[model samples]
Target: MNQNVRNHRFRKGIAGLGALATAAAGLFVGTAGATADTTEPVDPQLAVYVEVNSNDLANVADYTLAESGEAAIDMAMIFAANINYDGEKAYLHFNERVTETLENAQTQIRPVQAKGTKVLLSVLGNHQGAGFANFSSFEEADAFAAQLEDAVDTYGLDGIDFDDEWTEYGANGTPQPNAQSFGWLATALRDRLGPDKIISLYAIGPTYTTTDFSLFDAAGVLDYAWNPYYPTYDAPTVPGLDDRGRLGAAAIDLSNTSAATAADFAERTVADGYGVYVAYNLTATDQSAYLSGITEALKGESTVYRAAPGDTTPPTVTIKSGAKYTKGDAEDGYKRISFGLHDEGQIDRLYVNGVLKDLTDDRWSDLNFVKSGAFGAVKGENTLQVLDVAGNTTEVSFVLTK
Candidate 1:
């Protein structure tokens, strides 16, 4: 199916009437019931990669503690593929250290996994520099896979990701290799790991468009592939052309190149029936902006939804402020009830007593509700509710004494 058509259909399927209501109201809607109205339908095709180093992993436990049961994030991928053979003992190699770094990372990661976060351990498989080299041959590749398999088995890893960029030297400093080699390695790894485990690859940039993908059994072996989509200044030019001539060559300069291009690539890959993982550099917020674009693209679709790294279920609502009111104060009669709501996905509407109010725009952070309405206590109970972008609702109640 065409990407535009597929996206349209998916949007229709998930959004339905709830999104229309949000668009019409221009405010967040809340519900007493569990199911609330959402602005955009959930996009199952959407996934995010949280690249963590030893330093980042060390603080992961503390970082997650502040979430307070409201945030829903999924699938955190740790860098360097470090795993311990045993609790204290770690397997360290020259290419990448699996020693103390891995021990510390695993120590932090265990709690996250126990709390139901999907952990993806990424490793450099026969890469060019500072790692195992020359897995071009099948025998060499098999040995590398065996090592990886052992590491995975020992650590109880959820999945393994391959970052293989090995190839013969090319004229333009690009790797030139027969694509079949990669396919063979992927197939072998899948067979060894069995069906339940996820086998993903970090795909190359230029190779994504021109490489022969037939060798790899896309349906059987590969679960997903992530493309960095890093931007390059070099424009498309003829081979053997002078650098000066290439500079003058007319190129397609997209207005919002990052998001627009990334979305285009994601849509194309998804159409090929492959799940797309948008990779972002943690230090660079520009990558985050690119992810925002991808999010917008998915928002137009229905079946594709995004979940936060730690959360599986949707967000719940709580009364962060204005839980109590003092008697005889001027503001006492006019109760300004405030709420704290967090949704990993986008939140569209918030309703109080069936009347929609604008808390804030779509964001992943907590939203504060401060509506000026006649909400005072008459020696009875009061209710507040919050709605998310996926039609999920959470509520809190309080009693007032006069």
Candidate 2:
């Protein structure tokens, strides 16, 4: 899943949508092409990269969410959803409102760059509708290459992430129409971006069957691949493209109990030699707790932060200010309750009832994190708990009134 895809709620035709996204939502067709491959590999970068939604920059606008705008991270993929390919050119099409939102994201991302991360725009071709894979011939690939270069230069971006999935085929046994073109496109992008820029793809080792890995894995074509929520059965495969061929581990369930799960995956991949370790979409108040496991395996650091010492104080928890649930206050019987969970040390877990919930949209350093989202409250009681990494805890209970 391209986890950070925009909410494509624009009710316009592809033509109009294409026009709006680049020239304001009207579809424009483009040209394509093809290529062969190479096997030599480059060194893999052992660094941490994250995907933050450009559609909702506010969710990650805060410094706490900012992480290190620089060296603390390796790269941050600013996700731009639905960059449609028209057999002639590739275009990013979003409604006007979304366009403004992304512009804000572009500005907001500067802080992340300040801390040392290379922020790149990741354009994904939508799976359900017309996409890169939907183009009729190989020549359209060239069309996309030109347009993509324009976007990179226009936005002053560091690089691009090609996120394409296989949903274009009409039948089970049929061959993909743009497969060869896309391979050429990948090579074209590598050449256009030059040697230093970062280029990655969205695919796992074993699960992605439709894509011909060999085509895109040429020595200089790809830099990384995001194969999230890795399952044990698939095992690890050597990657294409030289330098830092890391596998991404999604943190949808990276928690206390699952730390070992992530650690094991990181260890084995590193042991295999060419692979690097990485984590995705993590928002814990204590981001270290989640990333520490992966880092331990990658660098063999003797001290795991989960076991490290500092502040031993219990965390403080409270319902965020301005929350309301009076008559007609909430939407569809679900009230949005925001929480402020903080600790002198690392805040580990924030749970509503017994199920743990992430209390912050952004990752907190060693003190605070904000968590907000809709809550399903019946006509009665609710409970919340916030725990520090050191095992100290805090709790809050309240009643909803209509």
Candidate 3:
């Protein structure tokens, strides 16, 4: 959830939004990639959230690890998609930009991920009666979890991050916040996503106070819990999460949080032995100094800004002839083709015959693939579609003869 919006609304007398504005957002405003200089030490656990509602998601990849350049943050979270109730039922709502980004994950999202960043979709509330911590039953939680799982799989995401806020309890006969609801939902998400996917929490709202910590299996079900309030240091009491799993330092809002304060937070996070540092709301402008404050304090390295303008061009896929058939036999008439995938961002998915045949977690930039066998091509006219992370695609049709 965006603290700026929450702070603005709360100042206008909207209660139940949880806490006052952060010191940074209330008083000030300010300004990804994992490109790091390997020569120096690195703190690869820094995390950030980008508000897709206002800023372009590509900005997250602009931060290089160091002077080496072209690196991405360890994790990049999409600010949010909401769980809103429609008077009949609660459903996931991805605003226009969020929907566009996810729908075209190959172009907008994959390129960032290609730079070695883990992309996560954050789920929050929309001032509706429904929320993560108000599921009426375990089954209800499971239903929501299924929606999240489908979204993660559909977009090829790394995981889901839960932020329980802006929910008007019992607004439309929806169940009120309960101790078990948050835990149930988290557990359900864990069950659906299996043991490998990340399930993190922004430690605020119902998740901050609820007694569901006992139910969280930090080693398995939960990855890390971050303090949501900015420029304030507070450690959440989630069970099973040790120093590595607890991010207690102040969470900085890049626009408002001062570089000194951000550096102090990073220093505290490092000195206190916390494994993760949190920063949010990165814009298109260069924020390398603010980032350098954190990186320097946390890992004794400087932050580098590569300064690439936003990408709007679509990716291209071209077929290459005269390729050796490495995997299949010519006797069976099953031959493979080689193709070049090029993009300003990164290539993410390939579809043949309207079916998804190949995908990657870390998207690619200018690559060649030679299918060993006749995976999608048949002995007739075949269609191929390639997509970039920003949802751009290049599709073509070619005839295959035996």
Among these predictions, the greatest TM-score belongs to 3
User: Model 3: per-residue lDDT, tens digit, 1-402?
Assistant: 455333532221322133434223341111111111133332437888888877777777778767445453678888788898988667888988788778878777888888878899988777778988777788888888899999999999999988877877788888777888878888889999988788888876665565366666655678877767665555554655544434444577778777888888888766555657777777888888779888877766788887555557777765554445232333443245566677768777777776675566334433243343355566656777888776777887655544
Evaluated against the true structure, the overall lDDT of model 2 is 0.46
- Look at candidate 2 and tell me the lDDT of residue 293: 62
Per-residue lDDT of candidate 1, residues 160-190 (tens digit)? 7654332222422323445455555566777
In candidate 3, which residue ranges exceed 4 Å CA deviation?
A: 1-44, 67-72, 307-402
Candidate 2 local lDDT, 1-402, one digit each (tens): 243242321112342333235323221111000111223342223333233432233223222211212132356555554555344344665444344544664565665555455666666655434444544454656666677676666656677776553234433232354445556666777777788877666542111333445766555676665432323212222235323334332222332326777667666555444344444443424456555566555554422222223446777755444434222223332233455666666676666656665544322422122223224333445566777765777776654443
- The residue ranges of model 1 lying beyond 4 angstroms of the native Cα positions read 1-42, 45-54, 58-73, 81-98, 125-137, 166-176, 205-212, 231-277, 283-402
After aligning candidate 3 to the native by TM-score, how far in Å is the CA of 100 from where it should be?
A: 1.6
lDDT pick, better of 1 and 3: 3
The TM-scores of all predictions, comma-separated, are 0.43, 0.51, 0.66
Sorted on TM-score, best first, the list reads 3, 2, 1
What is the C-alpha local distance difference test score of candidate 3?
0.69
Q: List the candidate 2 regions with Cα displacement exceeding 4 Å.
A: 1-70, 85-90, 94-102, 105-107, 166-175, 204-217, 229-257, 299-402
Worst 10 residues of 3 by lDDT: 27-36
